[model samples]
Target: MMRGFDSYASIVFFLIGIAFVWESRKISESSYGSNVGPDIFPMGLGAILVLLSIRLFYEAMKAPKGDSDGKTTPDYKRFLMIAGAAALYAYYLEDIGYVIGTFLFLLFCFQTIQRGKLVTSLVVSASFSYGVYYLFVQILEGTLPGFPSWLQ
Candidate 1:
């Protein structure tokens, strides 16, 4: 049987995509002397999201009836931990800087999801956090809170 969660998620994603697309139009249509506008990325992402959500809904609906494997209990505690960590991460991203905030968040999430493998988790989290920072800040020349003002 198809899970109701899948249907709900599809609807949510579809709505979010619609909102993004609609809101993107409010941004200025042209960038100084450039054909590409600031809205292009968001609009493209929204379009992709809309398409993926529709595909997900279609797949959910088309699944064979009575095909569900036995229900498995969700780990609500882990879910809550991750969710809370994510919220905190967002709030502290600017204060602590993207690299530190993301590293801490990812580390917490990794350990929360699966205990053990401390070394692996640390390496992976560090790699991801720094990689994203380097890509966006250095390569793309985008601004992100680097380090706390006190540290700089």
Candidate 2:
């Protein structure tokens, strides 16, 4: 891994996270009389991003100074595949619903990053997708497109 790249990325991510948090604050609180505001997700996500970026920066700095100039080729095919999947996920989300769409997307991404271990990938993807859906819809009283009618 390129040490310089990681350091630079950490800085960029830190800034982006800060921006997310800052911008999310502008959103109006409480939509349609619901306790959960539209800003809640973005604010929480931004906070998490900021924390993660700080950790990334710390790890990047603390890690040993490895090859600072190792130029590895980017995998275009995998990039295209993941990009295609993301686009399809966005396009089909309303129709397919959040849990299934997110699960499929995460599964595709995890498998793309590392093939094999289908069980691990499937379980992780499913758990995260369902957990998020449950948390948002039930606990937070937030609405999300649930399973498609076909599945229900």
Candidate 3:
């Protein structure tokens, strides 16, 4: 089971690395000043992820096999719940706006999937969503979704 988890994590990292590498190619050097290009960070991070994945894969391969002692299997229901919440978030992101969608996502994650306290989950989710919104919209001056004219 441990080895399986390691293998899965390694493969995920490997795929992420590949994605980063592919994305890096799209960033043109001319887009950035002579100092640095957008591709540089992506390529560097991709290489690091690839190296880490390789190391993890090797370690997992060398790890000892499972013991005779019985071990409990992972909770598939919980996994499904988390996956469902993520899917919901992705589906509603554009319609609900980032802040509201993210808050609802976090609340669902903490309350339904993680089984956290109601008050704690609500507070944390609201704070995190607001913080992210403020950072992106106010500090970074990034465009965010606004109420649609029709909705107004």
Worst 10 residues of 1 by lDDT: 63-72
> Which candidate leads in TM-score?
2
Task: Flag clash pairs in model 1.
Answer: 1-68
| Runs of candidate 1 exceeding 4 Å displacement | 1-3, 28-48, 51-55, 58-64, 67-70
Candidate 2 residue 106 Cα shift, in angstroms, is 1.3
Return the TM-score for each candidate structure.
Answer: 0.73, 0.88, 0.63
The count of backbone overlaps in candidate 3 is 0
Number of backbone-clashing residue pairs for each candidate, in the order shown: 1, 0, 0
For residue 36, model 1's alpha carbon misses the true position, in angstroms, by: 11
- Candidate 3 wrongly placed segments (more than 4 Å): 28-70, 147-152
**Collision pairs in model 2:** none
Alpha-carbon shift of residue 53 in model 3 (angstroms)? 6.4
Q: lDDT (0-100) at residue 16 of candidate 2?
A: 86
The order of the candidates by lDDT, greatest first, is 2, 1, 3
lDDT of 1 by residue, 60-113 (tens): 788666545346678899999999999999999999999999999999999999
Write model 3 residue lDDT over 68-105, tens digit each, in one string.
Answer: 12366777987898898899888877888877888888
| Predicted structure 3: lDDT | 0.78
